[model samples]
Target: MKNSLKLVLAVVLCVFLAGVAGFADEYILGIGFTIFMYIALAQSWVVLSGLTGYISLGHVVFFGSGAYVFILIWGLVPVWLGVFCSGIVVGLVSLIVGYPVLRVRGPYFVILSFGLAELVKNLVLINEARMYVSMRPVFGAPALYQLYTAMLLLAIIATGLTYWIRRSRFGAGLRSIREDEEAAETIGVPVAKLKLLAFAISGVIPAMVGAIFIMRSGIFQSGDAFTPIVSFTMVTMAIIGGSDDAPGPFLGVVFLVLLQELLWVNWPEVYMIILGILLLGFVLFIPNGIYGWLSEKYFGNKKNVT
Candidate 1:
Protein backbone atom coordinates (compact mmCIF):
# COMPACT_ATOMS: atom_id res chain seq x y z
CA MET A 1 0.00 0.00 0.00
CA LYS A 2 2.72 2.40 1.00
CA ASN A 3 4.80 1.51 -2.03
CA SER A 4 1.85 2.02 -4.32
CA LEU A 5 1.12 5.38 -2.81
CA LYS A 6 4.72 6.45 -3.28
CA LEU A 7 4.64 5.38 -6.91
CA VAL A 8 1.38 7.25 -7.47
CA LEU A 9 2.77 10.39 -5.92
CA ALA A 10 5.94 10.16 -7.97
CA VAL A 11 3.99 9.78 -11.19
CA VAL A 12 1.76 12.69 -10.28
CA LEU A 13 4.78 14.85 -9.58
CA CYS A 14 6.36 13.91 -12.91
CA VAL A 15 3.14 14.76 -14.74
CA PHE A 16 2.90 18.08 -12.92
CA LEU A 17 6.46 18.90 -13.90
CA ALA A 18 5.75 18.01 -17.49
CA GLY A 19 2.68 20.23 -17.51
CA VAL A 20 4.74 23.11 -16.14
CA ALA A 21 7.39 22.55 -18.78
CA GLY A 22 4.73 22.64 -21.46
CA PHE A 23 3.78 26.18 -20.51
CA ALA A 24 7.18 27.48 -19.43
CA ASP A 25 9.78 29.07 -21.67
CA GLU A 26 11.77 27.01 -24.12
CA TYR A 27 14.80 27.08 -21.84
CA ILE A 28 12.87 25.50 -18.99
CA LEU A 29 11.47 22.83 -21.25
CA GLY A 30 14.97 22.13 -22.56
CA ILE A 31 16.25 21.70 -19.03
CA GLY A 32 13.34 19.44 -18.19
CA PHE A 33 14.09 17.35 -21.27
CA THR A 34 17.72 16.98 -20.29
CA ILE A 35 16.74 16.00 -16.77
CA PHE A 36 14.35 13.38 -18.11
CA MET A 37 17.09 11.98 -20.34
CA TYR A 38 19.51 11.59 -17.47
CA ILE A 39 16.81 10.09 -15.31
CA ALA A 40 16.07 7.46 -17.97
CA LEU A 41 19.74 6.61 -18.31
CA ALA A 42 20.25 6.45 -14.56
CA GLN A 43 17.21 4.26 -14.04
CA SER A 44 18.33 1.91 -16.80
CA TRP A 45 21.72 1.58 -15.11
CA VAL A 46 20.08 0.85 -11.80
CA VAL A 47 18.01 -1.96 -13.36
CA LEU A 48 21.00 -4.21 -13.96
CA SER A 49 23.96 -2.83 -12.04
CA GLY A 50 22.15 -1.77 -8.92
CA LEU A 51 20.01 -4.86 -8.55
CA THR A 52 22.56 -7.43 -9.70
CA GLY A 53 25.66 -5.67 -8.43
CA TYR A 54 27.26 -5.88 -11.85
CA ILE A 55 28.98 -2.64 -12.69
CA SER A 56 29.15 -2.05 -16.43
CA LEU A 57 31.47 0.66 -17.68
CA GLY A 58 30.43 0.21 -21.30
CA HIS A 59 26.68 0.48 -21.16
CA VAL A 60 26.97 3.33 -23.61
CA VAL A 61 27.63 0.70 -26.29
CA PHE A 62 23.89 0.09 -26.46
CA PHE A 63 23.15 3.81 -26.40
CA GLY A 64 25.49 4.61 -29.26
CA SER A 65 24.31 1.65 -31.28
CA GLY A 66 20.72 2.78 -30.90
CA ALA A 67 21.56 6.33 -31.91
CA TYR A 68 23.46 5.24 -34.99
CA VAL A 69 20.75 2.82 -35.95
CA PHE A 70 18.07 5.45 -35.56
CA ILE A 71 20.03 7.86 -37.70
CA LEU A 72 20.49 5.24 -40.38
CA ILE A 73 16.87 4.15 -40.44
CA TRP A 74 14.74 7.08 -39.35
CA GLY A 75 14.40 8.38 -42.89
CA LEU A 76 12.74 5.14 -43.96
CA VAL A 77 10.15 5.17 -41.20
CA PRO A 78 8.45 7.32 -38.62
CA VAL A 79 10.76 8.67 -35.94
CA TRP A 80 8.88 6.99 -33.12
CA LEU A 81 8.90 3.66 -34.92
CA GLY A 82 12.59 4.08 -35.62
CA VAL A 83 13.32 4.66 -31.96
CA PHE A 84 11.36 1.56 -30.97
CA CYS A 85 13.23 -0.51 -33.51
CA SER A 86 16.52 0.81 -32.23
CA GLY A 87 15.65 -0.40 -28.76
CA ILE A 88 14.79 -3.83 -30.10
CA VAL A 89 18.09 -3.98 -31.93
CA VAL A 90 20.00 -3.10 -28.78
CA GLY A 91 18.06 -5.62 -26.72
CA LEU A 92 18.94 -8.37 -29.18
CA VAL A 93 22.56 -7.27 -29.10
CA SER A 94 22.52 -7.41 -25.34
CA LEU A 95 21.31 -10.98 -25.40
CA ILE A 96 24.02 -11.98 -27.86
CA VAL A 97 26.75 -10.22 -25.87
CA GLY A 98 25.42 -11.12 -22.45
CA TYR A 99 25.86 -14.85 -22.96
CA PRO A 100 29.64 -14.67 -23.24
CA VAL A 101 30.36 -11.56 -21.20
CA LEU A 102 28.06 -12.54 -18.36
CA ARG A 103 30.13 -15.68 -17.89
CA VAL A 104 32.99 -13.59 -16.57
CA ARG A 105 32.87 -12.02 -13.15
CA GLY A 106 34.51 -9.18 -11.17
CA PRO A 107 36.98 -6.81 -12.79
CA TYR A 108 37.21 -9.02 -15.84
CA PHE A 109 33.56 -8.38 -16.61
CA VAL A 110 33.96 -4.65 -16.05
CA ILE A 111 37.04 -4.48 -18.27
CA LEU A 112 35.35 -6.51 -21.00
CA SER A 113 32.27 -4.30 -20.92
CA PHE A 114 34.37 -1.15 -21.06
CA GLY A 115 36.47 -2.56 -23.85
CA LEU A 116 33.36 -3.42 -25.86
CA ALA A 117 32.25 0.21 -25.90
CA GLU A 118 35.68 1.39 -27.04
CA LEU A 119 35.67 -1.27 -29.73
CA VAL A 120 32.22 -0.25 -30.89
CA LYS A 121 33.18 3.41 -30.92
CA ASN A 122 36.17 2.70 -33.11
CA LEU A 123 34.11 0.56 -35.44
CA VAL A 124 31.48 3.31 -35.71
CA LEU A 125 34.17 5.89 -36.50
CA ILE A 126 35.66 3.70 -39.19
CA ASN A 127 32.29 2.84 -40.67
CA GLU A 128 31.08 6.42 -40.71
CA ALA A 129 34.29 7.59 -42.31
CA ARG A 130 34.17 4.85 -44.96
CA MET A 131 30.50 5.43 -45.79
CA TYR A 132 30.44 9.23 -45.38
CA VAL A 133 27.43 8.96 -43.13
CA SER A 134 25.83 12.05 -41.66
CA MET A 135 22.53 12.88 -40.00
CA ARG A 136 20.35 15.67 -41.36
CA PRO A 137 19.25 18.41 -39.03
CA VAL A 138 15.91 18.27 -37.22
CA PHE A 139 14.01 21.44 -36.25
CA GLY A 140 10.70 22.78 -34.91
CA ALA A 141 9.03 22.97 -31.52
CA PRO A 142 6.74 19.99 -32.19
CA ALA A 143 9.79 17.74 -32.58
CA LEU A 144 11.23 19.04 -29.33
CA TYR A 145 7.98 18.36 -27.57
CA GLN A 146 7.91 14.85 -28.98
CA LEU A 147 11.43 14.23 -27.72
CA TYR A 148 10.46 15.57 -24.31
CA THR A 149 7.40 13.34 -24.10
CA ALA A 150 9.34 10.27 -25.22
CA MET A 151 12.00 10.89 -22.59
CA LEU A 152 9.44 11.42 -19.87
CA LEU A 153 7.65 8.18 -20.74
CA LEU A 154 10.91 6.26 -20.94
CA ALA A 155 12.00 7.54 -17.55
CA ILE A 156 8.71 6.52 -16.00
CA ILE A 157 8.81 3.05 -17.54
CA ALA A 158 12.42 2.45 -16.48
CA THR A 159 11.79 3.52 -12.89
CA GLY A 160 8.51 1.65 -12.71
CA LEU A 161 10.17 -1.52 -13.92
CA THR A 162 12.88 -1.11 -11.33
CA TYR A 163 10.28 -0.75 -8.61
CA TRP A 164 8.41 -3.84 -9.78
CA ILE A 165 11.62 -5.86 -10.00
CA ARG A 166 12.60 -4.81 -6.49
CA ARG A 167 9.50 -6.52 -5.11
CA SER A 168 9.41 -9.58 -7.35
CA ARG A 169 10.96 -13.05 -7.25
CA PHE A 170 13.17 -12.09 -10.17
CA GLY A 171 14.47 -9.20 -8.12
CA ALA A 172 15.16 -11.56 -5.24
CA GLY A 173 17.18 -13.78 -7.54
CA LEU A 174 19.17 -10.86 -8.78
CA ARG A 175 19.78 -9.73 -5.23
CA SER A 176 21.01 -13.19 -4.40
CA ILE A 177 23.38 -13.14 -7.31
CA ARG A 178 24.62 -9.78 -6.20
CA GLU A 179 25.31 -10.99 -2.71
CA ASP A 180 27.14 -14.14 -3.86
CA GLU A 181 26.89 -15.67 -7.30
CA GLU A 182 28.36 -18.96 -6.24
CA ALA A 183 25.99 -19.23 -3.32
CA ALA A 184 23.10 -18.18 -5.46
CA GLU A 185 23.95 -20.82 -8.01
CA THR A 186 24.26 -23.42 -5.29
CA ILE A 187 20.84 -22.50 -4.07
CA GLY A 188 19.31 -23.15 -7.50
CA VAL A 189 19.03 -19.61 -8.81
CA PRO A 190 19.51 -19.43 -12.59
CA VAL A 191 22.20 -16.84 -12.27
CA ALA A 192 23.21 -16.77 -15.92
CA LYS A 193 19.70 -16.43 -17.32
CA LEU A 194 18.70 -13.85 -14.71
CA LYS A 195 21.75 -11.75 -15.47
CA LEU A 196 21.08 -11.86 -19.19
CA LEU A 197 17.45 -10.94 -18.73
CA ALA A 198 18.45 -8.04 -16.51
CA PHE A 199 21.07 -6.97 -19.02
CA ALA A 200 18.57 -7.01 -21.90
CA ILE A 201 15.98 -5.10 -19.88
CA SER A 202 18.56 -2.55 -18.85
CA GLY A 203 19.90 -2.06 -22.37
CA VAL A 204 16.60 -1.30 -24.10
CA ILE A 205 15.59 1.93 -22.36
CA PRO A 206 19.01 3.55 -22.64
CA ALA A 207 19.01 2.72 -26.31
CA MET A 208 15.63 4.40 -26.69
CA VAL A 209 16.95 7.40 -24.79
CA GLY A 210 19.92 7.50 -27.14
CA ALA A 211 17.60 7.55 -30.13
CA ILE A 212 15.63 10.42 -28.61
CA PHE A 213 18.83 12.33 -27.86
CA ILE A 214 20.09 12.09 -31.42
CA MET A 215 16.68 13.04 -32.76
CA ARG A 216 16.55 16.13 -30.59
CA SER A 217 20.17 17.17 -31.25
CA GLY A 218 19.70 16.68 -34.99
CA ILE A 219 23.15 15.13 -35.35
CA PHE A 220 25.26 12.17 -34.48
CA GLN A 221 28.99 11.44 -34.36
CA SER A 222 30.79 8.44 -33.00
CA GLY A 223 32.72 10.59 -30.56
CA ASP A 224 29.61 12.22 -29.18
CA ALA A 225 27.38 9.17 -29.33
CA PHE A 226 29.76 6.79 -27.62
CA THR A 227 31.25 9.21 -25.15
CA PRO A 228 32.66 7.46 -22.08
CA ILE A 229 31.50 10.37 -19.96
CA VAL A 230 27.87 9.29 -20.37
CA SER A 231 28.68 5.88 -18.94
CA PHE A 232 30.40 7.48 -15.97
CA THR A 233 27.59 9.94 -15.42
CA MET A 234 24.92 7.24 -15.34
CA VAL A 235 26.94 5.11 -12.95
CA THR A 236 27.67 8.04 -10.70
CA MET A 237 24.02 9.05 -10.55
CA ALA A 238 22.91 5.53 -9.62
CA ILE A 239 25.61 5.19 -6.96
CA ILE A 240 25.09 8.64 -5.50
CA GLY A 241 21.33 8.15 -5.32
CA GLY A 242 21.39 4.73 -3.64
CA SER A 243 21.91 1.63 -5.76
CA ASP A 244 19.95 -0.57 -3.37
CA ASP A 245 16.70 1.31 -3.60
CA ALA A 246 14.35 2.09 -6.49
CA PRO A 247 14.11 5.78 -5.62
CA GLY A 248 17.87 6.30 -5.37
CA PRO A 249 18.54 6.87 -9.06
CA PHE A 250 15.62 9.32 -9.29
CA LEU A 251 16.96 11.28 -6.35
CA GLY A 252 20.43 11.29 -7.82
CA VAL A 253 19.12 12.53 -11.17
CA VAL A 254 17.19 15.38 -9.56
CA PHE A 255 20.06 16.46 -7.34
CA LEU A 256 22.82 16.19 -9.94
CA VAL A 257 20.80 17.68 -12.80
CA LEU A 258 19.96 20.71 -10.67
CA LEU A 259 23.56 21.00 -9.56
CA GLN A 260 24.78 20.84 -13.13
CA GLU A 261 22.32 23.48 -14.29
CA LEU A 262 23.00 25.83 -11.38
CA LEU A 263 26.73 25.42 -10.81
CA TRP A 264 28.27 23.74 -13.84
CA VAL A 265 26.75 26.30 -16.15
CA ASN A 266 28.49 29.08 -14.21
CA TRP A 267 31.86 27.32 -13.92
CA PRO A 268 31.93 25.09 -16.95
CA GLU A 269 35.71 24.94 -16.82
CA VAL A 270 35.80 23.26 -13.40
CA TYR A 271 32.61 21.24 -13.75
CA MET A 272 34.23 17.83 -13.69
CA ILE A 273 36.39 18.76 -10.74
CA ILE A 274 33.33 19.88 -8.85
CA LEU A 275 31.55 16.63 -9.70
CA GLY A 276 34.55 14.62 -8.53
CA ILE A 277 34.55 16.45 -5.22
CA LEU A 278 30.86 15.76 -4.71
CA LEU A 279 31.29 12.08 -5.59
CA LEU A 280 34.22 11.75 -3.23
CA GLY A 281 32.23 13.33 -0.45
CA PHE A 282 29.38 10.91 -1.04
CA VAL A 283 31.70 7.93 -1.13
CA LEU A 284 33.47 8.93 2.05
CA PHE A 285 30.52 10.07 4.12
CA ILE A 286 27.46 8.34 2.67
CA PRO A 287 28.71 5.41 0.68
CA ASN A 288 25.30 3.80 0.34
CA GLY A 289 23.93 6.99 -1.21
CA ILE A 290 21.41 9.58 -0.10
CA TYR A 291 18.41 7.25 -0.28
CA GLY A 292 20.20 4.46 1.54
CA TRP A 293 21.27 6.80 4.30
CA LEU A 294 17.77 8.16 4.71
CA SER A 295 16.27 4.72 4.72
CA GLU A 296 18.67 3.55 7.37
CA LYS A 297 18.30 6.60 9.56
CA TYR A 298 14.55 6.79 9.43
CA PHE A 299 12.95 3.50 8.47
CA GLY A 300 15.60 0.87 9.07
CA ASN A 301 15.94 1.40 12.79
CA LYS A 302 12.22 1.69 13.28
CA LYS A 303 11.61 -1.60 11.47
CA ASN A 304 14.23 -3.30 13.60
CA VAL A 305 12.66 -2.09 16.80
CA THR A 306 9.17 -3.13 15.81
Candidate 2:
Protein backbone atom coordinates (compact mmCIF):
# COMPACT_ATOMS: atom_id res chain seq x y z
CA MET A 1 0.00 0.00 0.00
CA LYS A 2 2.78 2.38 0.81
CA ASN A 3 4.54 1.58 -2.47
CA SER A 4 1.33 2.12 -4.39
CA LEU A 5 0.76 5.43 -2.65
CA LYS A 6 4.26 6.51 -3.43
CA LEU A 7 3.81 5.54 -7.07
CA VAL A 8 0.61 7.59 -7.29
CA LEU A 9 2.26 10.59 -5.63
CA ALA A 10 5.26 10.33 -7.91
CA VAL A 11 3.07 10.25 -11.00
CA VAL A 12 1.14 13.31 -9.84
CA LEU A 13 4.34 15.19 -9.11
CA CYS A 14 5.84 14.29 -12.50
CA VAL A 15 2.75 15.45 -14.36
CA PHE A 16 2.50 18.67 -12.35
CA LEU A 17 6.18 19.44 -12.78
CA ALA A 18 6.12 18.74 -16.50
CA GLY A 19 3.05 20.87 -17.05
CA VAL A 20 4.56 23.75 -15.06
CA ALA A 21 7.90 23.55 -16.81
CA GLY A 22 6.31 23.60 -20.27
CA PHE A 23 3.99 26.53 -19.50
CA ALA A 24 6.51 29.07 -20.77
CA ASP A 25 6.89 27.63 -24.27
CA GLU A 26 3.68 27.32 -26.27
CA TYR A 27 5.16 24.82 -28.68
CA ILE A 28 6.60 22.69 -25.91
CA LEU A 29 3.38 23.01 -23.91
CA GLY A 30 1.40 21.63 -26.81
CA ILE A 31 3.82 18.74 -26.94
CA GLY A 32 3.09 18.12 -23.25
CA PHE A 33 -0.62 17.55 -23.98
CA THR A 34 0.22 15.44 -26.99
CA ILE A 35 2.46 13.32 -24.83
CA PHE A 36 -0.23 12.98 -22.19
CA MET A 37 -2.80 12.05 -24.82
CA TYR A 38 -0.68 9.22 -26.16
CA ILE A 39 0.28 8.11 -22.67
CA ALA A 40 -3.37 7.75 -21.77
CA LEU A 41 -4.07 5.92 -24.99
CA ALA A 42 -1.09 3.60 -24.66
CA GLN A 43 -1.71 2.90 -21.02
CA SER A 44 -5.34 2.02 -21.69
CA TRP A 45 -4.14 -0.43 -24.29
CA VAL A 46 -1.81 -1.81 -21.68
CA VAL A 47 -4.75 -2.64 -19.46
CA LEU A 48 -6.46 -4.62 -22.19
CA SER A 49 -3.50 -6.12 -24.01
CA GLY A 50 -0.67 -6.02 -21.52
CA LEU A 51 -2.49 -7.21 -18.42
CA THR A 52 -5.26 -9.19 -20.03
CA GLY A 53 -3.27 -10.35 -23.06
CA TYR A 54 -6.17 -9.58 -25.36
CA ILE A 55 -4.47 -7.73 -28.25
CA SER A 56 -7.50 -5.79 -29.43
CA LEU A 57 -6.79 -4.49 -32.92
CA GLY A 58 -9.95 -2.39 -33.11
CA HIS A 59 -9.66 -0.43 -29.88
CA VAL A 60 -10.71 2.78 -31.67
CA VAL A 61 -14.32 1.65 -31.47
CA PHE A 62 -14.46 2.62 -27.81
CA PHE A 63 -12.64 5.90 -28.47
CA GLY A 64 -14.90 6.95 -31.35
CA SER A 65 -18.02 5.94 -29.47
CA GLY A 66 -16.98 8.17 -26.58
CA ALA A 67 -16.33 11.11 -28.88
CA TYR A 68 -19.70 10.67 -30.49
CA VAL A 69 -21.31 10.61 -27.07
CA PHE A 70 -19.57 13.86 -26.17
CA ILE A 71 -20.67 15.46 -29.44
CA LEU A 72 -24.23 14.37 -28.79
CA ILE A 73 -24.17 15.87 -25.32
CA TRP A 74 -21.92 18.92 -25.76
CA GLY A 75 -24.67 21.36 -26.76
CA LEU A 76 -26.84 20.34 -23.85
CA VAL A 77 -24.06 20.40 -21.18
CA PRO A 78 -20.59 21.53 -20.27
CA VAL A 79 -17.80 19.87 -22.25
CA TRP A 80 -16.00 18.68 -19.11
CA LEU A 81 -19.10 17.03 -17.75
CA GLY A 82 -19.94 15.66 -21.15
CA VAL A 83 -16.45 14.11 -21.36
CA PHE A 84 -16.86 12.54 -17.94
CA CYS A 85 -20.17 11.00 -18.91
CA SER A 86 -18.66 9.84 -22.16
CA GLY A 87 -16.19 7.74 -20.17
CA ILE A 88 -18.97 5.86 -18.39
CA VAL A 89 -20.95 5.46 -21.57
CA VAL A 90 -17.93 4.09 -23.35
CA GLY A 91 -17.21 1.68 -20.50
CA LEU A 92 -20.74 0.33 -20.70
CA VAL A 93 -20.57 0.08 -24.46
CA SER A 94 -17.34 -1.89 -24.27
CA LEU A 95 -18.82 -4.25 -21.71
CA ILE A 96 -21.79 -4.94 -23.94
CA VAL A 97 -19.48 -5.40 -26.92
CA GLY A 98 -17.03 -7.51 -24.97
CA TYR A 99 -19.64 -10.06 -23.88
CA PRO A 100 -19.70 -11.65 -27.28
CA VAL A 101 -16.28 -10.52 -28.50
CA LEU A 102 -14.15 -11.57 -25.57
CA ARG A 103 -15.35 -15.18 -25.81
CA VAL A 104 -12.95 -15.69 -28.66
CA ARG A 105 -9.22 -15.60 -28.17
CA GLY A 106 -6.00 -15.04 -30.14
CA PRO A 107 -6.36 -14.11 -33.84
CA TYR A 108 -10.10 -14.49 -33.81
CA PHE A 109 -10.34 -12.05 -30.95
CA VAL A 110 -8.19 -9.60 -32.87
CA ILE A 111 -10.42 -9.92 -35.94
CA LEU A 112 -13.61 -9.42 -33.90
CA SER A 113 -12.22 -6.32 -32.28
CA PHE A 114 -11.24 -5.00 -35.69
CA GLY A 115 -14.73 -5.71 -36.86
CA LEU A 116 -16.08 -3.80 -33.87
CA ALA A 117 -14.00 -0.81 -34.93
CA GLU A 118 -15.38 -1.01 -38.46
CA LEU A 119 -18.84 -1.35 -37.02
CA VAL A 120 -18.30 1.88 -35.08
CA LYS A 121 -17.03 3.71 -38.16
CA ASN A 122 -19.94 2.53 -40.28
CA LEU A 123 -22.43 3.41 -37.58
CA VAL A 124 -20.95 6.88 -37.27
CA LEU A 125 -21.08 7.34 -41.05
CA ILE A 126 -24.66 6.20 -41.41
CA ASN A 127 -25.91 7.93 -38.27
CA GLU A 128 -23.94 11.10 -38.77
CA ALA A 129 -26.98 13.25 -38.19
CA ARG A 130 -27.60 11.74 -34.78
CA MET A 131 -23.98 11.08 -33.81
CA TYR A 132 -22.22 14.25 -34.93
CA VAL A 133 -22.26 18.07 -34.86
CA SER A 134 -24.43 18.56 -37.95
CA MET A 135 -27.50 17.49 -35.97
CA ARG A 136 -27.16 20.28 -33.37
CA PRO A 137 -26.39 23.94 -33.59
CA VAL A 138 -22.92 25.00 -32.46
CA PHE A 139 -22.88 27.20 -29.37
CA GLY A 140 -20.15 28.82 -27.31
CA ALA A 141 -17.57 26.22 -26.39
CA PRO A 142 -14.72 26.49 -23.92
CA ALA A 143 -11.37 27.85 -25.07
CA LEU A 144 -9.00 25.29 -26.56
CA TYR A 145 -6.44 25.96 -23.82
CA GLN A 146 -8.95 25.19 -21.09
CA LEU A 147 -10.06 22.11 -22.97
CA TYR A 148 -6.44 20.97 -23.22
CA THR A 149 -5.99 21.39 -19.49
CA ALA A 150 -9.13 19.37 -18.86
CA MET A 151 -7.69 16.69 -21.08
CA LEU A 152 -4.39 16.77 -19.22
CA LEU A 153 -6.18 16.35 -15.93
CA LEU A 154 -8.22 13.48 -17.33
CA ALA A 155 -5.03 11.83 -18.55
CA ILE A 156 -3.42 12.23 -15.15
CA ILE A 157 -6.42 10.71 -13.38
CA ALA A 158 -6.62 7.87 -15.88
CA THR A 159 -2.93 7.11 -15.41
CA GLY A 160 -3.39 7.02 -11.66
CA LEU A 161 -6.33 4.66 -11.99
CA THR A 162 -4.24 2.38 -14.16
CA TYR A 163 -1.41 2.39 -11.67
CA TRP A 164 -3.84 1.57 -8.90
CA ILE A 165 -5.28 -1.36 -10.80
CA ARG A 166 -1.84 -2.66 -11.68
CA ARG A 167 -0.98 -3.25 -8.02
CA SER A 168 -4.35 -4.46 -6.78
CA ARG A 169 -5.87 -7.92 -6.52
CA PHE A 170 -7.62 -7.36 -9.86
CA GLY A 171 -4.24 -6.81 -11.50
CA ALA A 172 -3.01 -10.12 -10.12
CA GLY A 173 -6.00 -11.89 -11.62
CA LEU A 174 -5.26 -10.31 -14.98
CA ARG A 175 -1.64 -11.37 -14.84
CA SER A 176 -2.62 -14.92 -14.01
CA ILE A 177 -5.14 -15.01 -16.84
CA ARG A 178 -2.55 -13.66 -19.19
CA GLU A 179 -0.20 -16.47 -18.27
CA ASP A 180 -2.83 -19.15 -18.97
CA GLU A 181 -6.56 -18.66 -19.14
CA GLU A 182 -7.40 -22.31 -18.59
CA ALA A 183 -5.20 -22.43 -15.54
CA ALA A 184 -6.62 -19.13 -14.34
CA GLU A 185 -10.13 -20.50 -14.68
CA THR A 186 -9.17 -23.68 -12.83
CA ILE A 187 -7.72 -21.57 -10.07
CA GLY A 188 -11.02 -19.66 -9.81
CA VAL A 189 -9.98 -16.38 -11.40
CA PRO A 190 -13.46 -15.55 -12.74
CA VAL A 191 -11.88 -15.09 -16.11
CA ALA A 192 -14.84 -13.53 -17.88
CA LYS A 193 -15.59 -10.94 -15.21
CA LEU A 194 -11.96 -9.88 -14.90
CA LYS A 195 -11.58 -9.52 -18.67
CA LEU A 196 -14.81 -7.56 -18.90
CA LEU A 197 -13.59 -5.20 -16.22
CA ALA A 198 -10.29 -4.69 -17.99
CA PHE A 199 -12.00 -4.03 -21.30
CA ALA A 200 -14.47 -1.68 -19.67
CA ILE A 201 -11.72 0.26 -17.95
CA SER A 202 -9.63 0.33 -21.10
CA GLY A 203 -12.62 1.65 -23.05
CA VAL A 204 -13.05 4.60 -20.70
CA ILE A 205 -9.65 6.15 -21.37
CA PRO A 206 -10.00 6.16 -25.16
CA ALA A 207 -13.49 7.51 -25.02
CA MET A 208 -12.46 10.39 -22.78
CA VAL A 209 -9.38 10.99 -24.86
CA GLY A 210 -11.57 11.07 -27.96
CA ALA A 211 -13.73 13.77 -26.42
CA ILE A 212 -10.63 15.86 -25.75
CA PHE A 213 -9.30 15.23 -29.24
CA ILE A 214 -12.49 16.45 -30.89
CA MET A 215 -12.88 19.50 -28.68
CA ARG A 216 -9.24 20.52 -28.97
CA SER A 217 -8.65 19.61 -32.61
CA GLY A 218 -11.95 21.22 -33.65
CA ILE A 219 -12.67 18.16 -35.71
CA PHE A 220 -16.14 16.81 -34.96
CA GLN A 221 -15.94 14.19 -37.65
CA SER A 222 -15.85 10.63 -36.33
CA GLY A 223 -12.89 9.88 -38.58
CA ASP A 224 -10.65 12.03 -36.47
CA ALA A 225 -11.97 10.44 -33.33
CA PHE A 226 -11.86 6.86 -34.64
CA THR A 227 -8.75 6.89 -36.78
CA PRO A 228 -7.18 3.43 -37.26
CA ILE A 229 -3.79 5.03 -37.19
CA VAL A 230 -4.60 6.35 -33.76
CA SER A 231 -5.26 2.83 -32.51
CA PHE A 232 -2.25 1.42 -34.33
CA THR A 233 0.00 4.15 -33.06
CA MET A 234 -1.20 3.60 -29.49
CA VAL A 235 -0.53 -0.13 -29.62
CA THR A 236 2.81 0.31 -31.37
CA MET A 237 3.92 2.98 -28.95
CA ALA A 238 3.03 0.69 -26.04
CA ILE A 239 4.90 -2.26 -27.53
CA ILE A 240 7.89 -0.18 -28.55
CA GLY A 241 8.13 1.32 -25.10
CA GLY A 242 7.19 -1.92 -23.23
CA SER A 243 3.46 -2.12 -22.57
CA ASP A 244 4.03 -5.07 -20.22
CA ASP A 245 5.18 -2.51 -17.65
CA ALA A 246 4.03 1.03 -16.73
CA PRO A 247 7.14 2.97 -17.71
CA GLY A 248 7.05 1.29 -21.11
CA PRO A 249 4.10 3.28 -22.40
CA PHE A 250 5.54 6.58 -21.11
CA LEU A 251 8.90 5.96 -22.75
CA GLY A 252 7.20 4.75 -25.92
CA VAL A 253 5.02 7.87 -26.18
CA VAL A 254 7.94 10.22 -25.57
CA PHE A 255 10.24 8.59 -28.08
CA LEU A 256 7.63 7.89 -30.76
CA VAL A 257 5.90 11.27 -30.50
CA LEU A 258 9.24 13.00 -30.95
CA LEU A 259 9.95 10.80 -33.94
CA GLN A 260 6.50 11.59 -35.26
CA GLU A 261 7.18 15.35 -35.04
CA LEU A 262 10.44 14.93 -36.85
CA LEU A 263 8.63 12.98 -39.57
CA TRP A 264 5.73 15.45 -39.84
CA VAL A 265 8.08 17.87 -41.62
CA ASN A 266 9.67 15.30 -43.85
CA TRP A 267 8.45 11.88 -45.15
CA PRO A 268 5.63 11.03 -42.74
CA GLU A 269 5.01 7.67 -44.37
CA VAL A 270 8.64 6.86 -43.90
CA TYR A 271 8.18 7.56 -40.24
CA MET A 272 5.24 5.20 -39.82
CA ILE A 273 6.64 2.50 -42.06
CA ILE A 274 9.98 2.63 -40.35
CA LEU A 275 8.26 2.60 -36.99
CA GLY A 276 6.26 -0.48 -37.96
CA ILE A 277 9.38 -2.27 -39.10
CA LEU A 278 11.20 -1.30 -35.96
CA LEU A 279 8.28 -2.57 -33.88
CA LEU A 280 8.42 -5.91 -35.67
CA GLY A 281 12.17 -6.03 -35.21
CA PHE A 282 11.80 -5.21 -31.53
CA VAL A 283 9.35 -8.03 -31.04
CA LEU A 284 11.78 -10.38 -32.76
CA PHE A 285 15.16 -9.24 -31.44
CA ILE A 286 14.43 -7.33 -28.23
CA PRO A 287 11.36 -9.17 -26.94
CA ASN A 288 11.24 -6.97 -23.84
CA GLY A 289 11.42 -3.71 -25.85
CA ILE A 290 13.90 -0.83 -25.46
CA TYR A 291 13.32 -0.55 -21.72
CA GLY A 292 13.59 -4.32 -21.35
CA TRP A 293 16.80 -4.27 -23.35
CA LEU A 294 18.35 -1.55 -21.24
CA SER A 295 17.20 -3.20 -18.01
CA GLU A 296 18.66 -6.55 -18.97
CA LYS A 297 21.88 -5.01 -20.19
CA TYR A 298 22.46 -3.12 -16.92
CA PHE A 299 20.05 -3.61 -14.00
CA GLY A 300 19.11 -7.16 -15.00
CA ASN A 301 22.64 -8.45 -14.65
CA LYS A 302 23.14 -6.59 -11.38
CA LYS A 303 19.97 -8.06 -9.92
CA ASN A 304 21.11 -11.51 -11.00
CA VAL A 305 24.52 -11.02 -9.41
CA THR A 306 22.98 -9.81 -6.16
TM-score against native, each model: 0.94, 0.88
| Clash pairs (backbone) in predicted model 2 | none
- Tell me the TM-score of model 2: 0.88
* Alpha carbon lDDT at 301, candidate 2: 45
Question: Which candidate tops lDDT?
Answer: 1
Q: What would the per-residue lDDT of candidate 1 be over residues 1-306, giving only the tens digit for each residue?
A: 396797798879888876775667778778888888888888888778888888899989889999988878867887789899999999998899899989888888889989999999999898888887743454431457667878888888888888788888898899888889999999999999999999999999999999899877777888889999999999899889987766889899889999998786698988888999999999899988988887789776421121
The C-alpha local distance difference test score for the whole of candidate 1 amounts to 0.85
How badly does each model clash, as a count of residue pairs? 0, 0
> Candidate 1 — which residues are off by over 4 angstroms?
134-142, 301-306
User: 219 in model 1: Cα distance from truth in Å?
Assistant: 0.1
The TM-score leader among the candidates is 1
What is the C-alpha lDDT profile of model 2 across 162-259, one tens digit per residue?
Answer: 66677788988998888899999998999999999899999998898888777666667766667788888888888888766676787888898898
What is the lDDT, from 0 to 100, of the residue 174 in candidate 2? Answer: 92
TM-score of 1: 0.94
